[model samples]
Target: MNAEQAAFLLAHALPPEARKDCWQRKFTRAHRSDLKRLGVTDTQAERLARILPAIAYYGTHGPSLAAARTPLVILAADAHKAAAALRVVLEGRDEAMQESRGRLLQAIESLHPERCEVDPARASFFHSYDHREPEALRLLTALQDVEQAAQHAVGCMPKAQTRAVAHTYPVELIDAALSLDGPAFHVSASAESKFRRVAALCYVAAGHGEPLRAIRAYLRERNASPEN
Candidate 1:
């Protein structure tokens, strides 16, 4: 094991668990020899241990864990530096999400002055036809309508208006709303096929293809049809 091996192990070992106490304990005891074999010095291994929890949290919450981890593995000056870089990446993600939330609020406010007020205390009312029933179904239907309208608008708009509104609330919010359920099974199947096609690209980007290929293959096979 060398630096490349160490990076590979770190990439795969990041678990989805939010609380990393068990992962940390097991990682320290079980992987010590492997880490040493990978040419990670004791000090570097300690730095990795310290950062594992944050890495795990960020991995589970972020849009693309592979994309988030790519820079750390590729660009960091050393193992310790990589750990610090991971923290910065996660912080940037948090800041971006905060900015998106602010933009969402501003967009909603701009729709007002039609003499309508949203009671923060009665936020549920917007979603609910029945006061006692939170209207998740209603919200989903509304989101679908928004997505359809946005797609049509984007298709019809002049290139300038399309580009301008690309950053606006309708496009962003509709996308966010639609993605809330994650990808559908058929879409996920398609994505897995696409992922496999791009495995080489990911490998070139990350300097290793095995982990990504393994994950993509798993997704593909998991959704594979018996007839096909």
Candidate 2:
């Protein structure tokens, strides 16, 4: 089938209620399960899974990461090469980035429930993937990698603060930042009280930085964005 036809079929295949509840709300493994049951191809599911967090983040946070530009630039200047990499994605609207973000948003829009499907009780709930599932195991592995990378990023932080800092932000955000793809720009300055903490950590973990110097810059930028 053609693109429009594929989109329509996908939309129609989804439970009326799941379409409604997930539109601008939280997405979970359970939602991913729904997509699979509806026969969404592995290719489609993986593509969607990779960027859904970014989509959800931007939906809740804001449309753009404009405020983070200066912080990212400063972090880059401080020898955080990863920051520079992420900044490039944010600043430039390359074809790949545009197409990826566009496709994700379109898919989400198609899944949005119609007015009649708004009631939660109408949607059947299913168990999300547990540790036993291959998908869950794969995700577990990826998260383990992210945690290890985050440790390097925050390695310079004090013994007392490191754990808290690492635990606060979602791993999905860090993964997005490091990928140097669509979600890289989805990291928002306003989303976290200590956005720079996670941002700097992602940068350092991704590579390049005098940790002490980078932390200083992150703290300095924290107050500059009053909205955060």
Candidate 3:
């Protein structure tokens, strides 16, 4: 489907009653539980919460995508990568010069969710040795390794502060990774208080111009310092 249609579908999927204006506002409290059932971790759930709504909106909105299994699986794979990239940024560098390349590439692979399903038919076109399930498991194992590496860094921050940083920082890293930006851009920029990188991209990809006008104002408000 075209980007405009996808954007409309995404915007429509969002519940009207939610308070936040971030990409994740599309979901309700119940939606959070839905994510857990899908095997998203407690830490990753909040980030996936932003991506799943778009997938759901498109999954049912388009005929070609809705009738097939492949698109959803592909989306599941991408969402997993985006989620993993965000998780990696949560790995504190402590003023290090750059993010690890090996780690970032692993970010894309490691996002295989624990609960992801693999049908035998979809698993292989040739033989048992070529099965997709094993490949998926290998990726999940990689993701776990990154999480373990980040654990010590996480210990350096308070719980509440980590959660706050997570809301914006991780999302930035996900966008940077996808955009193929340079290593200098890979590090998280905590000074940017707002989170328009992903949200704006979603809208732009949707080809919807209406939201851009309002989004500009919303950004200004977010960019403003609290004391001012």
Candidate 4:
């Protein structure tokens, strides 16, 4: 079947409520016989044959499909990376950057409600920790790591009081990562936040100055209780 025929058949298979003008545009001049051969039933085939032309005509002058898919593509890529990082933390595997691994895992787990459920496996990890100084240090280190990841994901808008410098990527991209659904959105939020914290820490460590002071001040003020 031709592209038009395939488009029509696909549209018909979708729910009636989903039959938007866009679908009609993509399926113009679709053939009934072609649709049936492609597995659409007679009833579905007939419906599509009627609506396809109008949809195609409207879409021809409407937004390009590429425009709709661009954000999706970006979000998908970001999510894949985040998921891979989360898997490492969940398995207790050594991540490339040890300091940020725990924080990364925490932020990721925070995004899901499943973490709050009483899973035996998760409980085992918490209980297994020995109450020793070394273990305590390790836990603290992990928390720090996760915090850094969260900050990076949010994207540091430079502030004056802290020395932490924000990453140079577009703020909109960070916002998109936080707001978009799917894996990339989650991953970007985690990774971006972690990266930002790391940058801030490095600047302080090198004695270059606190780059994120302004950002920290802003967060602090925002979280403060309002005056009566």
Instruction: List lDDT for all candidates, in order.
Output: 0.37, 0.38, 0.39, 0.39
Q: Over the stretch 23-94, how does candidate 3's per-residue lDDT look in tens digits?
A: 232444654455445333454434334544343332222234223444444555565675576455444465
The residue-by-residue lDDT of candidate 1 on 70-166, one tens digit each, is 4544432343444444334323457776565445445444654332344467667356422212232333345455545544544454433111111
Q: How accurate is candidate 1 locally (lDDT)?
A: 0.37
How well does each candidate superpose onto the true structure, as a TM-score? 0.21, 0.17, 0.18, 0.22
**What is candidate 3's TM-score against the reference?**
0.18
Candidate numbers sorted by TM-score from highest down: 4, 1, 3, 2
- Ordered by lDDT, highest first, the candidates read 3, 4, 2, 1
Question: If both were scored by lDDT, which would come out higher, candidate 1 or candidate 4?
Answer: 4
Report the C-alpha lDDT of model 4 over 4-25, residue by residue, as the tens digit. Answer: 4435444443345435644443
Tens-digit lDDT track for model 2 on 31-81?
546545544444544544443333333223322333434444444344445
In terms of lDDT, the best-performing candidate is 3
The RMSD (Cα, Å) of candidate 4 is 26.9
